[model samples]
Target: MKLACIENIRRQKQHVERYKRQLARHRSGEDISLKSQKTFRKPKQEKHLKSFQVYKDVLFDEFLDKSKKLQKLTNQILKVLSQVWESPK
Candidate 1:
């Protein structure tokens, strides 16, 4: 429970920081950072090709398997977050 809260807080901080950086870039009329000009890329059409891409880190692990016990715990977190779209305390 406590570890989940910490992870939520960390994600929230990252969200806020990205928003701040975007706002700063808008005000200055410039791209937010180096490499920011890259156009959006679609998800890989081939699973094997994605391994060479950035979201290689986001590949689903056993810990997030939909059939696992953590599945229900994950639902509860989604329920809480949906109520306000904010990370739980």
Candidate 2:
């Protein structure tokens, strides 16, 4: 029973020592060095082509499709005019 009491006192002393060390660290501001909130990622690089060229190509394709549609509409209007009204040469 006496040995058990001694062991308990020893364990309590160790716990107090640990708690004091932790307190000292907190007072010294050494325990606040936590992981950073912001993470760094590698910047992506274009491997195949330049960004401007890619965008220009996309815009050119769009313009070409629009021009084709306008040409078809104009042709239909001219055909209708030719059939309904005679054109003077």
* TM-score for each model: 0.36, 0.35
lDDT tens digits by residue: candidate 1, 1-89:
99999999999999999889888987998855655546556556765576657566665775477557677888988898798766566
Displacement of the residue 74 alpha carbon in candidate 2, Å: 58
* TM match of model 1 to true structure: 0.36
In candidate 2, which residue pairs clash? none
lDDT of 2 by residue, 1-89 (tens): 99999999999999999778767877987753233213434345643347756876677778999999999999999999998788565
Q: List the lowest-lDDT window of 10 residues for candidate 2.
A: 32-41
State the C-alpha lDDT per candidate: 0.76, 0.76
All models, RMSD in angstroms: 23.9, 15.3
